[model samples]
Target: MNTHKKQGFWHRFFFSLDHKDIGFQYMLTIFVMVAIGGFFAYVFRMHLAFPDMKVPLFGLVTNKDYNMLITNHGLIMMMWLALGMLLAVAGNFLIPIMIGTDDMAFPKLNKISYWFFLISVILMIASFFMPKGGLGGGWTLYPPLSTGDFGYNTPYKGFADRFFTANTFVLLAIVFEFTSLLMGGINFFVTTLNKRAKGMSLFKMPVVVWMINIASVLFMFSVGPLVAGTFMLLLDINVGTGFYDAYRGGDPLLWEHLFWFFGHPEVYVILLPPLGILAEIISNNSRKPLFGYKFIIKMTLLAGILSMMVWAHHQFVAGINPKAATVFSILTIIISLPFAGIILAYIATLWYGKIRFTLPMKWALGAITLFTLLGGFTGLHLGASVFDIYAHDTSFVVAHFHYTLFPTVIFGTYAAMYFWFNKFTGRHLNKTLGNIHFWLTFIFFNGFAFPLFLLGLAGQHRRIADYRQFEFLMQDPLPLYRHIATISAVILILTQFIFIFNFFWSLKKGKRVESNNPWDSNTLEWQTSSPPPHGNFETYPVVHHGPYEYNMPGKDKDFTPQNEA
Candidate 1:
């Protein structure tokens, strides 16, 4: 592995053990996946928006093709892009630096994890080219549909074998992705536990590190059942196992059980890290200490615990015992309290502080605001078992989760990117373009997502290729809503090119940062040079204060560095 200071591109990028290099690799990989996933969204949204109109590149999208696109879109965006960007990119880049370590505890494992992730991505993309499109059963891969007779009753007739092969590839790709994440999680735990700089105890670490650690632990434990479930699914598909086939004493709902168990916790696994990112940005940009630091940590932990208990909430209408549904509904509502507290804490941090409207700050604020609205939506509709039954398979669920995920994943990532672009690449991104990107994203994101709420409320079923098929959805005003969402989606997709161009063009030609601590924020990462070389610091840093100490009394400056002795 080449050192960070090495000149060769492949040596520095392709096969480097340095955590920063690997972090960049993850970011780049996610960028590509984002484009692919967005393309999938564009195609499918086109079908939804204008079902009869001929689509470019593939003509009209059949129901099977729509399923393939939607499944892969969800899979790619959530698992591959969001997880890779937040966990792999932010975790790898920030953890070592913020914790005052030179590198990850297992740098080799880190490198290997990324390579495996790349391989998984390759397999996932290749699966699309399979004889019968891609795995179209959906991202959840529900039992009977996922397992037996892939093309038996679907519109795409006479392609059972092809769909079967595609399903195998999807499962295999997910397996590899999970494997990579497991390796990375191990590295995160070990690094956080054993590798902090002197005086930097666990409590003194930044909230982001704390959140990532919690998320990692949550993922490690929760993902096991799903991994096993996938293998059983594979066997059922290929070797005639009856693990999920109800006809042969296997219950299809059993697959749902296992999937949602991992599935629900997996939401928090992706969520906690980005929530932490928002915490860091909110506190720093507000020029204040993070309010209720210890309390927030406790609340986050409670949320993690409750997240595991709420899996059955998703199964409320899936033939779950009514008593079980009630229990799960109660648990799901309980889980929201901690997050509510966290949100309140963020708001408290912003009260009566000198707020900076920097690029990252704008994105962070947008994320939190949107999240608050969506959080309300979740509480209103998803927390109640009765409401959930109505909204379960509707676009309401789609809008709700997209509200939750897009803000956290997409907006949170943009916050991190704008915040850290200078540190990562030694050049500041074009602020004008970034601001335009942020505004357009915020506008179009809401435009695209809010109508799904209306459609879902009107009982528009999710994952269907054409809304026109349903007479209720075909009624007046609903079609207009669909067209609105589709148009907004197109604008949303096109607006990203501004960010993409800015990212690359600025990488080479953006204004060079004058100082390492351009933000004048109180975090350890800023203590190092712009794009710190080789080992992160010339010497190990000793922590002298908590991660955020903005606007301390008797300080000459508003912010105080964590490393100041």
Candidate 2:
């Protein structure tokens, strides 16, 4: 029962089997990948901003280089940074403590997952150094365009000197990352189901735990087809198989169907955790119990189920039968209902309560507002098959998704970081710096994204290296909009340094928290020490109330801990 050990660096870090250690490792890895992905974004934004000007570190980004940057940026942020941080980092770190367990059901598997993920990151970074540059087929990796002849071939001399093409490296990196996540998903499912403390019934768990479980199930089920499809793509590229090659009777649309089948649900997989995080933050800061807890759970379930059926909506303009498109459009819109309920439930949680405008709360509230507006945009425009026909592959679609994802993944993660930093690092972040980071981020994020909507409305297509090439985009106002957005993006990227400094600086020099429950919250995580020890609880906690028990009329304290006897 004594889980603590005298450990060396590698034992504690690289090979640690403890869930907390693995979770920390996952977070660190996510930070590194996010920087790399952000660099790619900066490079591409520069290309878009000044088409003729050579970039500093990376000189003139060719069309191929631009494509690779876009592809990798999307893939890394979505797969490695967002998914890894939310599920691998948050899920591993929080689930065991919240569920009153010492560790994940399979600790060794958790370590292995992180290692596989690290390997994936290595391969992805190595791809950039390849003579031909990295993959250029975009993150979707659609066929024909993604095939070996079209995607892997490089004009550079000695491209064949490498054992694997850059495109192959990209696919391999994905395969490794997917494999890592699949293992993590299994761990989440098994641990959450079997490891709860006594009196912790299914309904007694926090909404975040439930959301993680649901997202895990969705990921496990949806990713199989894409895994299979990726392997087929590798074969078509390297081994000369024609699974997606049209001239050999294979169909390119088959890849789209398979990819989006996983891709659409994948968005929800990244989304649900943030929603769950927001739920925790919003309720705790508002001094209220989560409104419509059961309702939110049921709606989240429905949303996950409906997510599978709506994949075809992404293919509306890809020449599917008109009736099929109609069916998909309707299903896509219908999926919005559960999300609407969840959003409303959050709003209800904040209704007329003693709302604390803490840094975390501000982020949670911002995420809700941003997600609602973006979600509304999707419902109003993109959900309609007819409107999607015109909006397909435009900057509008890009802006819409960034709105959903940036708020959910990035803002939600920030909220969790602020809310939980004391628990994780045993120190409070510099509040003034935190507020500065949040406000600047909020202003610049909107400044950067809102103009993409305008450009898309002006018929500006996505993935083009030079917008000036198109006569429509070259028109006075459209070009000017891009310039404004580019400036906003640069400022937005620069503002992140404030957050980075605050995070690391606080780890050593910030104010030390005097109590474990610094937020005065009710979750089981607060029952243990700040940065809880190796066997999380000295005595395993026994749950009494549900996670969100706040403002109980009879209780003297405003919040009620689940483990209170």
Candidate 3:
């Protein structure tokens, strides 16, 4: 369909269908969104640290601004930052390489997906500049709050009118995004299922490819309900449909059902790729085979299947049928088991192996440890109906998600970036700066999130600017939490400089990576050149063994490329 001919550097560099170009574009977009969304976080944290405080450069960020910032932050980070980069960038970049393919099955389709992704992302970012400001209805955009008024009496017009219009744009952007992702998911799923190199079997593929394939299948099916729900919500708001209108006997709970159906699985879809990166990095750096590799694969599939039945857990407080809530609660706890198996598998992989503390390895190891601890503990809290009652919608809930996902997603992304910087830019990142980046991020990340758990335990609800009304936190929410969180946030923001320095400084001046297999990686990706040319492989590589086959007997070194063995 792309009858366009490739011209010169810019087209080949930025808009080309080469997997590497697409991958870098994905990473570049995510970085841009992070800068924008992260600024909102910085200001949001400033507000938390000093309630109703006047900020420099932007003046006072009122509660309404706070709400809009947080909502947009979640949408941007989750969709644009995490999903956009991991699935679109990493998935598109790595899948063809891992499978030993020259390029995506349909290069033109792949390029279109990236372009549409860019357009959708632009529209999403543009939402903040809307006439009435962006949608302030939380990331979930649950009705009433999302469909009702803006809740604050600003100079803005009626809440319903603004909510309807702002949210319409949001839905439209999401629809475009969904279209792109759906095509991408279908392509990836089919490519993995059918297009392995001459000898690569299902098991011979890299764990990252497996993770992406699973996520693709999950996204393919899971996105439909939300796409449908968005249309219904739009119709209800504009066309006077009763889809979400209680007056027309349509229950708002229906919206919750449809959203969470997509919502719960979307987390795993975002997570699985990074987890795959962790699996690869941890195994390679440790110089050991990934322990329970088969188990991890099985668990990934199980988690995908179990995600569907557990959607109603979000509705526990929404007055879903008590029996349904109970079922969902039980299912939610059970679903954590497969995830537990995954954590144990990661931990087990690290036991008694050669531990290299390289930047990428450090991030991989740190993510596994922190993510497991936070994921396990918070899951325990959320699993029980009794605690869920207290923790629901509280800062505890926020802290749990931040701890569990923040490290995994953000750290995993950095790990992927560091791991592939050579492949992306043909140069290595500065290790010294990278280590500093890691430590500061690790410390401040917890600092920013931990107090939230303590505050939430003391009954601080989420989505509010003023927690001073709660006397329990009155003794010193500012000192114990707000100030500390703000300081941590500032430190966190500064820590990224080490990365910016390393990323750009090294892009031009860093040591050149001579060997394609820098880490002695076992996957087929290592078989290609550093930043492989227009077609991935100079010549088609025939994969000969399973991925992660490190330390096999008679191997020249500790690892052998799947394409070589």
Candidate 4:
């Protein structure tokens, strides 16, 4: 592989793995994925808000198509938008930089991982254009519904038995993507363990690196079961296996167990990095050391340990035995204790500090508040066996994930984008436009998802296209709730323009930056030029202090870089 600089668009931008190039590509791919996923969200929301209302803009769609939309939307948002973008993009960009590595252990392999990811994305996009349409099963691709024949008798149908072919492609693509993620994880973990410049110790590494390292460990181990399960499903579809076939004495429940075991871990995998980024942004902008930094790291470890044990909580209502449910429920609540500690630590850091309400800080703070409340409260409902009976699989369930995911993961990605844009481009983003983007998202996000909690509480089942047909909900239908949600959805879609505008506008015309440590960060990445040249540090950076040595009594400035005095 050539280590020398190149000057072409595809060579430099599309097919490069100089961590910076890979990071930007991951961001761009996921951004496009988010847009596609958001469009699906809009369509699904429209159907839910007005169960029988014909969508004026999407007249080609029908009720069966709507159900398919719901399934595809969930899959795209979870895997494509959240995981693909957050971990792949943000992880690629920040990991080496945070740990003070010049580049990944193997840059060419990094490039290979990204190219495979791009291929995976292309395959997923091709699913939508499949002859029978696309894979219609929810992201989980639960059997019976997912594997059954495609016809009117089924709840949702858009194409032919093309689900088998389309979903097969989706699965293959996902396998490649996960392979890339695993490779990246291995690189990150090894780099952190072996390559921290000259004197940076593990304990001295930033909390962001710690969080990401933990997440990478979780991904390495947790993803295996899902890969096994997906292969089983693929075989059951194509090669004629009885792994999940009940009539042949094969248990479908086994697949569920395998899927959720990996599935739930997948959520944490998507979440922790954003929180890591949030910690970095908040600590830097607020000009204070992260409170209870060690405690937060311990909590992340706890979250990972508990993540594997609570997969059955997702199966509580599926007849997994009351005693087992109770056990899982107790463990589920226990997991939240660590998260509570992390939240408290963040809030404590902000107490009486010199707070800067920049765009990155605004979203970081917003995510901390939103995720803390939602991850804690709804978690209680799911953790207690009694409430689980009522809230499981309802709109409340949907709202709970949306609250945790949209804020922590999605917003964190955007925050990192703003915080690092200048470093990547050597230019500052327009703060005014960024602020507009933040406030609008803050309002519309809650406006759109919060009401689903109420609707779920009122007994609306999830994944159905026509709610009016359900006689139980007729007496007290949630028309007003639906209206507000749909309106906000449309508005939210439009608000993303502020982001698109700010990003491109800043890249081309914003103020040029010369500061190496733009955020005055103590981490090693900040020791280099904005958009650090080819090899990250001109020479090597030797760490001399801990990550957050801020506001010492006799320091020249309030803080000093880890490599500095």
TM-score of model 4 (CA atoms): 0.95
Candidate 1's residue-wise lDDT over 142-184, tens digit each? 9777753542223333345533477888888889999999999
C-alpha lDDT of residue 233 in model 3: 78
Instruction: Score residue 441 of candidate 3 by CA lDDT.
Output: 97
Which parts of model 1 are misplaced by more than 4 Å? 1-4, 148-164
| All candidates in order of TM-score, best leading | 2, 1, 4, 3
- Check candidate 2 and list the clashing pairs: none
The residue pairs that clash in candidate 1, if any, are none
Sequence-dependent TM-score of model 3: 0.94
lDDT comparing candidate 1 with the true structure: 0.87
Question: After superposing candidate 2, which stretches have Cα over 4 Å from the reference?
Answer: 1-6, 150-163
- Give the Cα-based TM-score of candidate 1 against the true structure: 0.96
Estimate every model's Cα lDDT from 0 to 1.
0.87, 0.88, 0.81, 0.80
Q: After aligning candidate 3 to the native by TM-score, how far in Å is the CA of 81 from where it should be?
A: 1.4
Judge candidate 3 against the unseen true structure and give its global Cα lDDT, from 0 to 1: 0.81
Tens digit per residue, CA lDDT, model 4, 459-511: 88887767777766666557787788789978988899888888888889998
Per-residue accuracy of model 2 over 235-263 as CA lDDT, tens digit each: 77766667876777888999999999999
